[model samples]
Target chain A: MSRRAQENLVALVVLGVFIVAIVMAFDYGQRARMVPLPIALIGVVLTLWQLVWQNIRPADELNIDLLEVLTRREGEAVARNVSSNFDEQSAHQKRQAAGRESVACGMVLLLLGLVWVIGLLPGVFLFMLGYFLLSDHYSLPRALSYSLGLVVALYLLFVQGLGIALYHGWLEEWIRNL
Target chain B: MIDAIVAGLAALMTPQAMVFMFIGVIYGLVIGILPGLGGVVAMALLLPFTHGFEVAATLALLLGAHIATIWGSSVTGILFNVPGAAKSLTSCFDGYPMTKQGQATRALGASATGALLGGILGAIFLAVSIPLVRPIMLALGPSEYLMMALWGLTIIATFSEGSLMKGLIASVLGILIAFIGMDPVTATPRYTFDILYLMEGISFPVAMIGLFAVAEMMKLYVKGGSIVDRQMTEERSTVWQGVRDAFVHRWLIVRSSLLGVWIGVLPGVGATVGGLAAYAQAVQTSKTPERFGKGAVEGVIAPDATVGANEGGGLMPTLAFGIPGGEGMAILLVAFIGLGVVPGPDMLTKNLDLVFSMVWIIVIANIFVTIIGLGVAPYLARLPALHANLMVPAVLAVCFVGAYATRGQIEDVAMAVAFGILGYLMDKYHYSRANLVIGMVLAIMIERNLHLSLTLYGSDFLLERPVAAAMLAFIIVTTALPFVRRWWKRRKLAAAGGRA
Candidate 1:
């Protein structure tokens, strides 16, 4: 997708969220929805405006600031010197970046899943060790050492020092029951 | 007052109080460096240990930990993009960028020193303002508070970056998200989706951990580099440079500290709001406003100073009116009760010496934190220079674990991950996460206060309240000034071009 298309898609998603919120807000009491309803309506209007404005403008001009638009005359410089820090990349590089982002996202989900299934300590330990090993960032022994040291530190700080009851995971619960 | 001040210093001169203060500062710093834990947690954890200790020692431990956490949280926000707590979120805006430029030690030094100066100044202000607090507190109403929240929202323009529309939308979305919990006015759950956990609303710290910390790690994984470039790290600034930066920006520090103290004096207004407000004021007042959110040292200094001074401001209501300023102050109130220190008008006349002791603790503890912060800043600055592969997992683990640790809920971990994805997408697109956080911070305050203002004085509340009316006018002028200035500059340039 083009950058403009991606921006439009996100804007549309935001618009949809506001619309859904406004609809759901009506189900509440008058006092309950008083603040939320107006806020959501404002959100919808702002987002819809963003969607329309981004789509209508040329790709280069799409990065225009609203404040500048309000302040400047017609055909005046609308693009503020506000850098968004986005760099231009080739199609191949974009694809490569997208792939890396997907992997990163997947790793985050995998860690989350691991934590959910096997509790925080074991989950974090496994995730860290796997990441260290798979990324070729550390030797196996070093990875093991780092992971163990972190888990031990977590245990001492949270479990012992603070007296927090960490989640023992569904797998641990099942195994213990069996 | 002089006698009480001397008595306060003499009381804290005890070896037990000094030792406790040291231990509390260290513990607070450690907890503050952790992603989810903040001063409240540090103080709450030490509550049980407060028993049977001397009054000075007990207050030292509790208040010292609270003071230390302000700098502790800024350390992470500066070095990593991960804020230790919501109050430090503004620090991450410029502090992390400074880190990326390998100026992490400088950022840390400025943050610590800003806090130290703010703390001392706030302590002095607290002592001076004690006699004048009650009428000031009574003079402001819910309408004034609502205006203050609106004033906070007006600064969304500062963080809008390139797109005010997108920034407003992000802030609106954040406000909507804050409405997910049970409504304070009507007791009706607004957007809970019937989930039991949602009734309590989203945990601010958990969402913050996911938004900044987890999101940054994901970005690191994709970008394939350390947070600070190796080339940049070689030319890193010294800690003294940062300390000097804080002093050079002394006027900004004083202004931000006063703002912090004022916000602290207001009941239920938190350091989170104070920090963000300070940042907003910094941006608004700066001649080169464009340097903010991109490694302006003032951006780092303003918020840290505000947060540091906030502790002293927060104590006023807690000590004077038996009303806690914020959650940390609430916990301190609990400790005060245990220590047999009554908080009311009597507290002023009877326990004036005790109040002075707490003030002395704030000043002394801040000095200790700054000393320790400067000592370790060089080593802490090197953490970001580690390879992305090592940092990604290490930070993510801490973030997820910290998210769970926040409320001891597994669901908060899931919430953190979800927000992480949202944060990454928001950053990828041009949404202002800072605006969103500010929106979230002020939403409940605005909503609750608006309801109260409406109920108490009806719709014409602003007209009825002179202070609120003035604040509204101030908000309008400040919010419009930048656009007006820009337009005037552009017109002048256009005229110059025609002549040329």
Candidate 2:
């Protein structure tokens, strides 16, 4: 059955085609549009050419298992750390997809961003409290200690030390007015 | 020269300077011990505190912290085999082995000494090389520097495991990503997707911390396994023996410093490469090559020397040419500009003394960092074996804070986490993250330089610049040499198999 590798290849091919359409649409950009047009044009060309070559290649038939294929490799090679479990490699690949959720990455980022817009104390408080309640990384005492440490440290650094403006959230506003 | 040395010696003698030196060294060690934090990160964190401070005191604090981190990283590598930074990779080879043999103290001591020695040698080279730096830098044209950058990138293919083609693709992706911000020559956005933040482009530190630091933290959380038990054998390791191992490897320190300095002199390559390359070269030439990655003192010394040399070498281009040597140094160069220092021959003529003073700072910082680093390593070595749960929460908090503090943007934190997951997948899949980082770092320069050369001279740019043509030829030859060697080896192996 066709799997993730095939899907990735197809996605890349489709992306290449899409970029080519962008390149074509932006062909007029070189003449009329000045800086970004010409700059992006070169990037589009290089990216499209690379994607097509990588994805739409005639992959020669080999004895290598489809599931066990490594998309990339790095660092010093060792004798044993490499996965040699060919029999259930496909299943392992499926399991590895959980990593691709990448939601945790996005969520953590958004969480940090949200704090800046609101205020540091509020941000830290919300983040710790949220994690304490929601995440498996919770114990009431630990969360309390963490939250207290985070809030106090941030207050010391950004507030007491740097003397930068405290994030003007509702709590901060109330404190200021009081 | 006489005046410069006397001034430097005077600077080192100040009580305040000595105190800050210890502070910087210990700070660096602590920062270095934590995974995903390196000298660059530590220095960046310390940069804020440097404002309005006395120059010598500031340098001591900064350099001390930076030097200590290198030693700090080796602690993790030796006891747990987790590299603190890319440079510490080789430490795992010999470090962990010595640890398993219950020689953790000795290994830690040796690493500390190596770091101290390497730091001094690198700083000395930096000091001696200052006067000659300008002429060499002035001689280096864009074409030659471009070739140098390409040569560094080609090493990725040599180092990468599995398909070179895949590594190339990853590198290209990295270059393309590096293209995400502003075009240097034209000052236009290339791939900012209409975001204002994209206009300035992504900060290198933010990207690095995220890609290396945040992503790494996430991996640790998911893996749910501590590679070391800090609780096991908390007895103080032999300190004097580690110190003895250092003296035994004196020649190795000089050899590694030269390696680091040579690589550092290149425009784009910096301390990380110098450190790892030093480690690799040390291992390659060792009598017992097998002993690397298992806590060989050379692993620590080689990287430390290279890192110090890289700082000096990186300064060469940044002061002479306007181009930066590496990311962290690039920021420092910007600070120089903020202080109204221009980077050209004129500045060299007018500010030779200030340049000498800076060189002096590097030397003094290294000496102080070493003393502090050696003194602190045994104490710091005790940290890694702490329960993962405790370390994880605090470290995770720092990761978030560090990511946020870098650019003051939360998206960066997210980017780091995404990159971390990507890093983990890449790590597991055998994809070279170093290639990705290098590609990301150098991509803008390659594109911008090529664009300038093209725009300035059109397609006949190479012919117009004969030096460029020659450099291009060099780049082609260097890139091709690896494939040729690979092909020959494969052919020989296949022929032997056939004959059998």
Candidate 3:
């Protein structure tokens, strides 16, 4: 698939899954009912709109060029990118009319769920430190120092200064209270 | 007034209050200098610590810290072209340009003094607005608040810079995030999906830090960059010229301070709207309007004044009605409740002393902040130019600590990290993150207020209420005004072209 179709397909798949989850959440009493009612309706509408718009709408006529928009902020850069991409823009529009599968925001939610699994401190410390080192923000020595410093500061501020209990997650909570 | 001043000074002069005020001011400046975090995050983080302090002492810390951040944010925006907060984004327009022009010292000085003057005048407006607050609170109900929020959102049209649809999309996304927790009216979990931690909803500070701070950090990493520009032009001007410019733009100070106070008093508009509205007004009123984005001193002064004034204005509703104006004020409201001060009209009559004490804190904090802010102007202006190596680790550590401090939840830290990556992507992609952040901040208030209005008055909420009707009309006008101005300018340009 071309890039636009690819992007829209991703959005639609996510919205489609959300519609289902929202439908399921309709049973969470009156409160949960509020969410699914509007969310499902909106999700359905957005998905259908995405699907219909992409099928009928000619891409070249559209003002927004997503790739060009992403690559630059200035108007001239946009114009330059658009001009350079113009010849292939028509040819790239030809794409597979078959087999497509889409996923949900399940990955995002899974990330959150795993966050709870690891507990707050270790999970966050590792995530931030790992992201830093992996992303090449710092060398190993620097990343370790930064992460360790952040943990110490956080401990001092929250645990020592404020005296609040930290989130231990369900497993940690079970282990500690037991 | 003199007697009130003396009494206020006496009440504020304690060693503890003085020390706390100093600490809060310094802390606020540093926190503001850090990209992503703003005044609200600083206050929220400090709130959990102020639990045991006396009212005066607490105000010393909270009030001082809040005032000091206005300058702190502007300094970064001017020196680095990277705003410390969203409101300071406007400062980047002229500030960075001036920095490029080798007028960094003048620009830094101007922003600092503007903050000082703007803050003092804003405080004055706050005190003057006090007597009216009681009746104002009484006249306001949920319906009025809902209308007020609608009016607040109209500002997005004004702030969209150009594209209203993109801004609207950004705002809708914000509202979506705000709706993530339980329904305010039905107490329903709107989008929580049974996660227990989602019960209280995403802490506004956590989301804000994640959206801005974390995003900035991620962008720095992805781009392989430093936080500050770290370039030097010959420092050609004395700091006092900027100081004189502050006094020179005294009227703008008063005007923007009033704008800030007016927005602040409304009890939900907060500094984000206040700053943008003030900048918009400053640009509208400037004689040499073309100078605005190229380092107009008044442009710097206007937002600073509004930021100060906003604090005082925010205190009005927060103190009078026990209704917080913004996230920062909400924390302040909680502090008041913990101290056994029942807000509303009762605060005016019974706790008049305390009310005046807060007003005094505003004046004293601004004065202290100004002195400290001005003293450090020349040096702090150089932070953005720091080597990326040192800046990256220190800032990342501080930001993580900030995220963790909110709710004492590690998930918040992860959220910050994830959002940091998102923020960097958004910045790279040319989507206005400020609009997105504002949408997030205002979304909860909008959703809650809308839910309350819908629940209370049914879906025909505005149809029955006069204030709502009037506000709706006002929103129509304000929303159209920006577009009308833009269209008119376009037409005028076309007409000029045709004539040529």
Candidate 4:
């Protein structure tokens, strides 16, 4: 997708959520609904304004951003004063960023799944090793060293030092019983 | 007052209390340097150990750790772009840029000194203001609180990434996220959607980790570089330069420190607002406002000073009216009760020395943290040069675990991942995560107060509450001041050109 399309998609999603929230607010009693209803309505209008304004504005002009000057850093004045349009490689960069982000976020999800299934110790150990290996961050021996060291330190700190009863992996529990 | 100060010094001078205070400061730094863990978690972890300790020792440990975390939280922000806590988020604006410019040591130095001075000023302010605070606290009600929250929301004008509309949208989204759990006044779940976890609401720490740490790591992955990839400058900015910078901006430090104390006195405003407001004020007042967010020394100093002082402000309400000021204060209140100290008007009259001891702890802890922070800054500045490979996985591991640890629920990890994606998208677009956070922090306060105000005064609350009405007017005027200034400047330029 083009950069603009991606940006629009984000705005549309936010607007859709607000619309759903507005509809849901009606089901609540007067006191419960009061705040959410107006907030949702205002959100819908603001988001719509953003979407429409983005499309209609000149490509080379800056958006009528409220915090434009306030957000600028020392070197950013020149860059920020200009319009936020697609640079020559913006779409390409955006695509690459999206892909990399997905992989990174996917790794986090994998860790969560691993923790739920295998518990904190093994899950953390495996995830770190797998991430380093898969992402080509380190060689095999180095990855193992870092992962093992981290896991041991965590075990000492949390289990031994802090006396936290960590979740035992199902496999470990099964093995212990056997 | 003199007796209280002497008594406080005497109480904290005990070997056991001093030792515990040192240990607490160190432990607080460790936690504060980690993602999603802050003084709250640090205090919570130490709560169990406080049971058998002496009141002085317990206060020393608790308050010492809490004070240490204020500066400790700025470390990650200075070294990497990641803020160790929400209060530290403002530090990253100029701090991370300083790292990029190889001035990480200087930034760290300024942060330490600024925090130390801020803490001292805040303690002094609290000590002096105690007598004056009772009437002010008594005069304020829900209507006043609501206006204060609205005033806080005006800060979104400064923190937004670029577009004002996008910033407002982000703020609304943040407030909406805060509405996920049960309504404060009604007990009805607003947007839980029948999920068990939703009933408890989205964990702010978990959300913060996702928004900042997780999202930042993803950015690192995409960008493919260490935090400081450029060649190191041979001319390293000395730590003393930072100390000098803090002293040079002494006026800014004093103003921000007072702002922190003021915000701290207001129950529920918290250090987050204090930090952001200080930054906003710095930007608004600076001759070189453009230098902010790009390694301006003032940007780094102002927020640190404000947050450093906020603790003293927070203690006033808790000690005066048995009303906890913020989350950390709420936890401290619990510790106070455990220690058989009833926090009320008598706290001022009978237990005056104990209160002063708390102030002394703040002063002493600040000195300790600054010493430790400065000593480690040069060594810590070397961290940004570490390869992304080691940094990314380790940070992510800590973030995920920290998220889960906040609530000990698997679902929190999932939510962290989800919010991580959301945070990334927000960054990719123009949505301000800071604004989102401000919205979330203030949402419940705004809603609860609005309800209370309406119920008590029957919709004519503005007329009924003059203080609140005056505050609302102040908010409007302050919020418009920037735009009005810009327009006036533009008009003057145009008139000059026409004459020319």
Q: Number of the top candidate by lDDT? A: 1
lDDT score for residue B422 of model 1: 93
The weakest ten consecutive residues by lDDT in model 2 chain A span A60-69
Displacement of residue A13 (Cα, Å) in model 3 is: 6.4
Per-residue error for B215 in candidate 1, Å, reads: 0.6
lDDT of 4 by residue, B362-448 (tens): 999999999999999888988888877888888877787777777777788789888887888787676888788889988988999
TM-score of chain A of 3: 0.48
lDDT of 2 by residue, B1-500 (tens): 66766765676667887787777776676667655567777777767667675665666676566656666776776765556765665566567667655567777777766665665666577667766765765665555555545655655544443334344545655665665666666555656667877777666555555555555555554554343444554445676788887788878878877767666666766665565556655654565543454346666566666665666666666776767777656766655654556886654556555556566666666666556655665665565555544444455565655555555665665566666666665554444565676677556555555555666677777778787778678656654554454456668989999999
Which order, best to worst by lDDT? 1, 4, 3, 2
User: Which parts of model 2 are misplaced by more than 4 Å?
Assistant: A1-139, A150-178, B2-4, B26-115, B161-163, B227-256, B262-303, B314-360, B378-388, B428-430, B452-500
What is the descending TM-score order? 1, 4, 3, 2
Using DockQ as the measure, the top candidate is: 1
Q: In candidate 4 chain B, what residue range of length 10 has the lowest lDDT sum?
A: B227-236
Tens digits of per-residue lDDT, candidate 1, B1-500, equal 89999999999999999999999999999999999999999999999999999999999999999999999999999988889989998888889889888788899999999999999999988899888877999899999999888888877876664567788888999999999989999999878999999999999998899888988888999988888777746636999998999999999999999998999999999999899889888887887666777789999999999999999999999998989999999999999999888899887888899989999999999999999999999999999888998889888988888999889999999999999999998877768777788888999999999999999999999888899999999988877776566667778999999999
> How many residue pairs clash per model?
0, 26, 10, 1
Quote model 3's TM-score for chain B. Answer: 0.81
Q: What is the interface RMSD of each candidate, in Å?
A: 4.0, 7.3, 8.9, 3.4
lDDT for A14 (candidate 2): 35
User: Please, what is the TM-score per model?
Assistant: 0.96, 0.71, 0.74, 0.93
lDDT of 3: 0.64
Off by over 4 Å in 3: A1-178, B13-17, B30-58, B69-114, B158-164, B225-252, B272-303, B321-354, B387-390, B455-459, B496-500
